[model samples]
Target: MNGRRTIGFLLLIGLVLWGCSGVHPTSNAVWIAQPEFSEVDNRLYSARIAPQKGESPYFSFFLLTLTNKSSVDLVVDWNASQYLFNGKPQGVMVFEGIDPEAVKNAMVPLDTVAPGASFSLEIMPMRLIAWSPIKEKTAAARSISPGMLPIGENGILLALRHGNGHITIPLSVRISREGLP
Candidate 1:
């Protein structure tokens, strides 16, 4: 009986350690979902933070998918929006393409989506990214570096506007990773 009890205790401890890791086993991107404020609709407009795929070694971006389930136009107010990282205010920039040198500290303008349409935006933390130029062989290239936030709970707060007032969506995620991969 004592031997069986000892084995059970070991198994319990192992399971606890595994749970503490808190990482997605299969997919590359994993965000701990927020039960509230994740998905909201201002009568006719709706928005949600879609899952991000294809994470880079120096990861610093979020893919947000917005849908207009109503029959009218909606606008994503970037001016009234904010990025929430680790429960703090973070500046963000939305842009197209994957060029590292092209990304700047400027935020993307407001998005006006037609009725019954869906779209996605690739957003990155402005201050969380660092740029450096390096010359190799005979050419100079720029590299986008990651911030100190390698592991923690981080997310973004989005603002959507219409003819009336506006609605806010807050997405929080739990991040776990090795330091600076």
Candidate 2:
């Protein structure tokens, strides 16, 4: 069963790495990452990030669980939030059910979290999942090829708004690929 699932996953992820940031075209490649929320130290909010259930560990989409710790309602400004790769902005993040056209055109949505409340969802970088002027349409981790993304810091910088101010939450990620045949 596991072998069948892996084969299916590889067959589904037909994206060629090409010239992604960390990958070399003519070699065996493997993507490595470790995603967690413990490093984010902020007064306004806290968050946890992880891969989705039954998904590939090849750095595709994942779950984001954000908690509001402030006294005021916190807004997840999707328009302002960004995906970071190698410590740079890749693009805005997007969730399931979001219109691909909106992602292409940068039309994003915002979510509000009441004080002490939590907001949870699965998400990935729109640039990694949607059609764009600079990028062709790709699904899930198809664009995140091994060797394309250099082995370094990569993650999301969440934009949170509260009352008249805002705070940025950084969820750093590192992933690994081992035991694959």
Candidate 3:
């Protein structure tokens, strides 16, 4: 009788732990959906071909959606990065110590997103040309060498840092064979 009781107790504990991971069941306020390669917008987010003046290029535009989840107002710092499925890091994007003017342009910050409520920022697309020379140099340093394939696209992981921990979001990128202008 005791042996059966122990097995049942273990199973109950496992179920509770699994439920607490708190991952959203759907792409709602609790969860953010990662963009996939086939996901369409004319702008090529990661491309190899040098952009012409009129070409539609894509760059990292910060989009923040904050949900307090807890009963109390949550004030937290946010950060993001990209990586491959095998745990190899592709790139990291951080906002720490960045100039206020630049962040103001890239992000839409909220003093308080409010409990159980969310705030979002749909940033304007940025072009590759706007990145600093240092950014370009770093891209070259990576063995992959930042270049978008006409068809090949990769998935990236995004990390949002807050309160000594983080929530990660996944994203994917693909370049169209069809040229953009």
Candidate 3 on 1-181: residue-level lDDT in tens? 9999999999999999989877533312221222422121122111111111121233223333444555545443322344332344444333223333544454534244455655443222221113344444453342111222122343435444434455454545433333222
Cα lDDT of model 3 overall?
A: 0.37
lDDT of 3 at 149: 19
Candidate 1 vs candidate 2, lDDT winner: 2
The residue ranges of model 3 lying beyond 4 angstroms of the native Cα positions read 1-80, 83-88, 94-113, 122-151, 154-156, 161-165, 179-181
Task: Write one digit per residue (lDDT tens) for candidate 2, span 48-164.
Answer: 776532333355665788888889898888878887877788878777556656666766667899999988987777665533433644664333222122345667788878899
In candidate 3, residue 52 scores what lDDT? 16
Q: Which window of 10 residues has the lowest lDDT sum in candidate 1?
A: 28-37
TM-score of 3: 0.33
TM-score against native, each model: 0.57, 0.64, 0.33
> Per-model C-alpha lDDT, please?
0.60, 0.66, 0.37
- Candidate with top lDDT is 2
Residue 136 error, candidate 3, Å: 20
Q: What tens-digit string does per-residue lDDT give for candidate 1 at 28-65? A: 43333333225555657566653343354323566677
State the lDDT at 148 in candidate 1: 35
